[model samples]
Target: MKEVYITKISKFLPNRPISNDEMEDKLGIINGKASKGRRIVLRNNQIKTRYYALDDDGNVTHNNAQLAKEAIEQLFDENFTSSDIDLLSCGTSSPDQILPSHAAMVHGFLKCDNVEINSPSGACCSGMNALKFGFLSVKSGQTNNAIASGSERISSWMKGHIFENEIKHLQALEDNPILAFNKDFLRWMLSDGAGAFLLENEPNGETPLRIEWMEGYSYAHELEACMYAGGDKLENGFLKPWSEYKTSDWSEKSLFAIKQDVKLLSANILKKGVDSLKRALTKHDLKPSEIDYYLPHISSHFFKDKLYQEMVDNGVEIPWENWFMNLSKVGNVGSASIFLMLEELAHSGKLKKGQKILLSVPESSRFSYAYALLTVC
Candidate 1:
């Protein structure tokens, strides 16, 4: 098998940065009332600014596929174009449509020649899955070059009108007048963006990051859903999928809105993540001292200290100085977050040859985790 190198990295963060004060303006007030949980979520997430694909009028400016397409365009130059790509792998929790896969839609927009395409669906780990697929394809000599992307266009779903039906239903039942915290909180937490990575058999740029290895693990068998959309969780810990619900029940129950069991996430997310990291390190015979940079995909600053303590408890401590994170500036772009962080660090000019970088992503959807080791060459 051959080696795979990440020759280029790029990101598209949609329109201008939206500050905490401007978030509700972009996403709009739900049920014509301000959110009570917005400030708390923003404070915990510590996201100072983020981008959205919507204009001031709450109209979508770019769909999910377009965001991925724009990011992919940044990878091309006079030497390489879309036609040079042998495989396209895209991952997104919020695709523009349900029928056509995200990669298929992106390919239609690129207008490039036919090539192998893959669309991996999930939460944050979806992006890492796409990256892994591209890596294995190139390493196995199935393709000479590949483009992997992670993107989300969830702003449209978070708009105020999307929840009007649910608000009315709750009011009719004399239930809680506001949207549930599980669904309302996410409106302030997530933003829109896309990021892409160019992989090849040989390094193309002046400083290439070689993919040493990638590892992933899931605890779904032992855990129930922690974060979800297009469904509701039952008392028995089963997720009643959207397909089982009637059309009217969809909006009435806000089944499409992103929801999180905060208690469940707080309990297992970090512990499971650190456990997976330990296993990956053991499998690869690596040590914390060998890592020069640590890029962790944390959804909020709330988990920053907790994650550190978890690592310390597990005896795999990577000091704070070695960490690199852009969650404050970019918000949680979901699956695209890891790619966006890599794009920033790869172009930051701080990397040196032979320095090792570790990437970690934890998906609370079902307590899944992914880790990767890269070396600057």
Candidate 2:
């Protein structure tokens, strides 16, 4: 198998840091809510919240399609695009369409006829699975050069009615505000993001990273825990999903269930990840202690606990002391979690040659998907 290398990566976040305090003030979150662990806090205060970036014209710019284009454009500029890129993949949840796929949407923007595109919809695991497929494809010589971009549009998931219902519980207190600023954060913590990477086969020049090998395992039983049941937006964007006649039943079931679904799914996903890694490395007799860096999905703050527990159960030694949290600051970021982490590491100049990075992804629709080890060389 030919070695597939991650030659370059880039991330484009909306400028202007939105601090927790600022977010609370702007969104009207209060002391009781703040003290009740209602707000999502980032350990790194220097980290900024990411959002949809608008052009100077301020047009609520860049739907999912445009966002993909801008993200890829920045990545190409940062790493230098080549007309020779063999394959392009878009890993996304907010796909532009269910038919042609978001991969083709990005391909259309790039306007490259030479490359084949595939959009994978593995929910939050889109980034990991897409890149793993790219690496595996390159290893098999199907392509020498490839690009993977992971983008999420959590804004689309924000329904006004849902937001209103969630905030109604706050009792319209001007001083007592919403949790996590009492906006959409109360319903969901994951935010929006777009991250891209350029991968090549056999780096002929100076390179700091290479994808050594990758493998994934799937658990399909837990799909119900996280789901998007197709909102009421018509294709023409006319009728609202909930605009149909009101139902007769009027019961006050909690607007949201605090059931431990994400938490449970996190534990299950991490457990499967450990098993998959052990099985993959057992083929070459490697262990967790041999890894240099570990990058896993930051679904929620509790994810770290799940990872630690899984490592302990698997008897795997994790060399991570960095807490390595990103969920709250950028929200969940769905498919962009691992890829964005790599982009951040590259931005900070921390990714060095001869290091091993272990990546695992916990997804929504796809249950759990993970990668073993990708050596940097």
Candidate 3:
């Protein structure tokens, strides 16, 4: 069987680093005003600072395509041009336009011809989906060189007209304004960033990360609705069309309906994700003790203890000391998160040659999970 290796990783973060304090100020949240709830959510998420593709006045400076273009540009070397790329797989939760897919827009920006483009947009786990597509393309002898990229401009959308109107509507309707717009909580949790990885069928570069095994699982039927991106769910359980959402009054329904069932999400994510991880490990006949690092793309630090306990419950004691995260610095960049985390980890100079690493991404949008094992070579 042919193998695939990640030869390089490149990330691009915008200039602005929005701190919690800055976030509160931007939201006009005053002291002792929902302070307890704010503190709990922020502390639980373990997010101190996150980047935004915004200006000083909090206006969007860059969209998804531009961010992706910048990140992909960083992956190119003197010998590799846009023509060298056989496939471009881009995953993003928020895209610039509906017509031109994020991958196609990036392809246009790169001015490349004859390269295949795949833009898979949805929940946060699409990063792994993009990677899986590119990996299979190379592993199946269909392509020699491929680029898997993930980019997000979530901050701009979160702060856009729809959410702001929803916040106001909720505040007007409920006595406790802070808790009213509960679904808007993610506004403070997610930000902007983009990352890209160049994968080759052969070991073309020094210290390439070799892919050992990958697996995915989903438990979407476990919940009615947990997290969502487009269109509101109607009373009949069917999703409203985007055109209807655009044509109707915003007050009639939320443009982007999000129901983050904290209890359900927290309870099932770790269990489902750990089960998926165990299956991957077992398929490869590997054990927890063999992995030097466990890089998990958990959306919040609130799950840290639960995830650890879940692994222990499963009898696979991947120690907390062996695990590391960058969520505190980058927040959750949606589908771009795992790629951003991987970029920082790889460039930190902490990983060693021949060490085994496990990368897991658990997405709540559909209760989907993805797990991969990589060896530093």
Question: Estimated TM-score per prediction?
Answer: 0.99, 0.75, 0.91
**Candidate 2 clashing pairs?**
178-182, 190-332, 232-241
Q: Please report the TM-score between candidate 3 and the true structure.
A: 0.91
Locate the minimum summed-lDDT window of 10 residues in model 1: 24-33
Off by over 4 Å in 3: 25-37, 167-181, 233-246, 249-252, 257-259
Show how many residue pairs clash in every candidate, following the order shown: 0, 3, 0
| Candidates' C-alpha lDDT | 0.94, 0.60, 0.79
Q: Model 3: per-residue lDDT, tens digit, 230-332?
A: 5665665465655665554453345654446566676677877888788888888898999898888888888888888888999888988789789999888
For candidate 2, give the lDDT of residue 322: 34
TM-score pick, better of 2 and 3: 3
Question: Positional deviation of 79 in candidate 2, in angstroms?
Answer: 8.8
Q: Rank the candidates by TM-score, best first.
A: 1, 3, 2
> 183-267, model 2: which lDDT tens digit per residue?
3333335445688877777763345477766666666653343333232223452323222424311111122211123343444
> Model 3: which residue pairs collide?
none
For residues 65-168, write the lDDT of model 1, one tens digit per residue: 99999999999998889889999999998988788899999999999999999999899999999999999999999999999999999898898888899989
Candidate of highest TM-score: 1
The lDDT ranking, best first, is: 1, 3, 2
User: What TM value does model 1 have?
Assistant: 0.99
